[model samples]
Target: MTLHQLRIFWAVAHARSFTKASKVLGLAQPSLSQQISKLEDDVGTQLFNRNRNELELTDAGIFLSRKAELILSSVDETLVGLKEFAEGTRGVIAVGALSSIARILLPRAMHRLSAEFPEVEVDIHETAPAEALELLYGRRLTMAILATDSIASSSVSFHQTEVFSDPYVLAVPRGIDLAQVNDVEADLAEPDRAVVNSTIQFNFGSQHKRRIEAWYQKVLPHYRVIGQTRTYEVALSMVQEGLGVAVVPALTACVGADQSYDVTLYRTSLPDRRLVALTPSQYVRVEPFASCLRHLRETGDDIALPHIEPGPPLMKAL
Candidate 1:
């Protein structure tokens, strides 16, 4: 019934192990158990069943766990709001972002926010773009950075700011000879040049795959994609081993010098991809989240976004 008990219950439900919850809460196992026991008694339900080395939530436990998570999250947000109010600063901002943007934008934004508004605590969640939008809609995330091309719903208001634009570029190995060309432009233009056999890697559940498939349909109709992997690093490694050529986002192709393969960047006639910041219409008018969005829009050129666009479509995949 108390916030302390709810916290313990939520942690146990999330971790599915009392011992793990104890470690996370920095409490002894016995103390954690006693607190959970009191909560169960007050609720008049047996929340968990101990089934030979496993903890399973009972029906009532499952029901309470969801409610408890919402309660605790709201309390946490309220406390952050109060703290910010007391300090005379913008309140806390909760942001969700795609993995690609998380790699480059989040770190720099966090650093800048800390320097400029130390009182504002910026919490970031990194996940697929689709999940980030769901969180934003549920009011769990105050804002998000997502792909502009992927935005589907009219209900969710977004302040679109172009963070980075990367043209699709082909990554090929060092020694390969295109039959009819000496340079990138010539290679792209050559009618007799062989289409390099390549494997395309992408996050399995990304919107970017559609764009990529569309690109292939239009340009490389005869070429065979030998493989597909989930991450850019894996795809890049495969390309480095001379497995095949890949069309990757230009930013991700900027690998460090330590990588042992030669990479060639080429211009593609494919449409350029863009990264944008999204938020609810109401939040756009708020102070802290608004300021953060403004800062990102103003300084987007400096941030590097992943080649893949963030977010899932509003309609379910058939």
Candidate 2:
């Protein structure tokens, strides 16, 4: 009956548990149950049926959940529009982005955003692409910025704008110099060769993982995966510690304007990682969100990527 009740029901339906919904909404399970009970009473029908311990939506619940999604999305967009017009861009815009991109680009983008609209505020959520999409669909995030290849093709139905393309480069310990070595197998010493052949792999995005696997197989035929990680920062840090080498986006190894990393970067034949801003089509025409997207693009354009030397011929081929 109320928007609050609809939100609670929506969360419960998505989460499939009153307890989990409570954690997400920051409310008690009893409170959520009470609201859902009141909602079922107002509708004059039971919405959910508990099968064993799991909650399953009834026919009525399925219909209401679909309608609630549309209603809530429209209400949130309208509120954003009205606030921008009434308060002159004095409002918070919740954004979800990968940690590295957030750390490297958001600060400058926000600096520009604040200069233009000093009253505006940004709420950033550092998350992976899947979680970012989840938050975006739940109306907890107004926009999400991430790599276009990070999420499955079927999951990207929202409007997206290309922000920038980051080249994938190989990160090796500072001690191993790739610039002087033409053949990884023949030119490097035994220890350095072992370091080059020992790869630290990433285990997210099926397409990306497959491509990286094939690249390693072709580039280093006898290579072995010594470690795996989900974050680029951790992978690069491991390389800095001489654990193993990794292929990562150039921006991930960069700290602020003048900061540098101990690892060395070498350009590879790998395709560039295209970063994009994803939002509902309606938000594209809305204020503040539109401006924020522009700022993201501008910030990406101005970035000075860390120096990446050309890889050896054997490493660059295939």
Candidate 3:
């Protein structure tokens, strides 16, 4: 009957468990149970079939779940329209992005969003690309910035824009000899045997792991991975000790005297990593989402930077 109850029901249905939904909604489990119980009583039907393995929604619940999504989206759209008409901008826009992307891109993007529409508030949620896409489709997020290849979706209708391409670079210790061996055949013929004996690996998934392994086999021949990490910065630190060469995304592999990553970068034949900004197809017409996306495409390099100038632009989005 009430919007709050319907919202709670939608969350529970999406998550498939009262416990998870309660945590997401920031409410006590007992309170959520009571609210759901009251909602069911008001509706005069049982909404879910609670069992040990999982919380399964009943027939009525399933139908309502789909309808609830449209209802909530329409409500949000109307509110956005009201804010745009009255205040000449939006009220609030929720966005999700991977940590790596967020650290680099959100700074400039949020800066432009605020500069263009002072009253528009943007909420930044740090998440993986897959999770961010889930949030976007669930009507919880307006848009997400994700690597084009990092997307784990098979079939999801959405609109995306290619923002930029980041090259993959080989990170070797400053003392390594590959820095001068630009010719692949020559490097393979007379590589620093010591460099091939020790390698650093940063694998995010099985596919990425295979890709890295394949590249290593092609270039480093019988190379050994001396250290392993999930992040480029850590792998780079290992490279600093002459452990082994690391292949990483260029965005994280950029080198500078002040950057503290004391490694030499070499161009690789590995495919470049492409990044994209995406929104659910339904929200493409939303002004707030469209405007926020413009900030990224227009100032992508500034937004995708790992760090920012001195001052408040570094602050996380509200």
Give me the runs in candidate 2 sitting further than 4 Å from their true place: 9-23, 28-66, 153-157, 179-183, 205-207
- List of clashing residue pairs for candidate 3: 105-303
- Model 3 — which ten-residue stretch has the worst lDDT? 309-318
Top-TM-score candidate index: 2
Q: Candidate 3 lDDT, tens digit per residue, 161-185?
A: 7766777777767765543443334
Candidates ranked by TM-score: 2, 3, 1
In model 2, the clashing pairs are none
What is each predicted model's overall lDDT from 0 to 1?
A: 0.63, 0.84, 0.69
**How far is 228's C-alpha from truth in model 3 (Å)?**
4.3
Count of clashes in candidate 2: 0
